[model samples]
Target: MQWSIITIGKPGHPWVKDALDLYWKRLRHYARFDHVVIKEGPLDKVEQQIQAVCGKDPCIVLDERGRSLRSVEMANWIEREEVSGRKRVCLVIGGADGHSPGFRDKAQVCWSLSHLTLQHDIALIVLAEQIYRAYTIMRGEPYHRE
Candidate 1:
């Protein structure tokens, strides 16, 4: 299955961009990956932009109030999606004010990286790394150590 990470706004921080590049490169070996950025804007506009890209794929929103999963659990979840015949999975990371009520309600999965709120750029970076780690774990690689 293909994976798409759709985020609002671009990563302005050098560190965030660097980390994204690193992990994205690592994740490339495992599955098809797509990174999409919607121009920063109001919640409704951003949600529309995200939805346009999502098409029929299951959308997973990243929000502080969402369910928290361990790294291994995330891997299993992705694996299950593939087994269940999902062709693509879109992970949406909203802007500064978080997701709109409509977006949250329609998302197939709402995943939280942590209880603490994170800057958008940092959240993107962390998401990239976790995705890479998850793939490594699934492949029985030594990259992830319990």
Candidate 2:
């Protein structure tokens, strides 16, 4: 199974890029993991950017209004989805103002990282780490446990 993260804006900070790269490297060992950085623009334009990257794949948009899940649960969810033969899973992170209601409605699923607002750069790091953690847990590694 392949997994890709599509972000609305470029990651500007060196530290954020480094952290995101670390997780991407780690996740590559288990599955195809990559990130697509979309150009920052108007909300409609950003949505168009995301749409182009996502294509027709199953997309999970990260939003504050999305469902919250435990790490183990998320791991299981990914495993099930992959086992069911899904070609790809696209995770999207919106811009500073967040996603439009139309985008939210169009997403297959909306995932929430936390209640507090997170910078786009920081959110990318957190999302990468979670994907790594989810894979590790699915593989029965000690990275996550009940």
User: Which pairs clash in model 2?
Assistant: none
| Candidate 2 local lDDT, residue 101 | 95
Give a tens-digit lDDT track for model 1, residues 1-146.
Answer: 89889888888888787888888888888889988988987888788888899988899999889999999999999888878988999998888879987789999889999988888888888898888888889889998999
The CA lDDT at 102 in model 1 is: 77
Q: Model 2, 15: alpha-carbon shift in Å? A: 0.8
Q: Which tens-of-lDDT digit does each residue in 8-52 have in candidate 2? A: 778988888789778888988888977888888889988988888
Q: Pick the candidate with the highest lDDT.
A: 1
Instruction: Note the Cα lDDT for every prediction shown.
Output: 0.88, 0.87
lDDT for position 33 in model 2: 79
Give the range where candidate 1 is weakest over 10 consecutive residues by summed lDDT: 15-24
Assess candidate 2 and give its lDDT. Answer: 0.87
Q: State every prediction's TM-score relative to the real structure.
A: 0.95, 0.95
Clashes of each: 0, 0
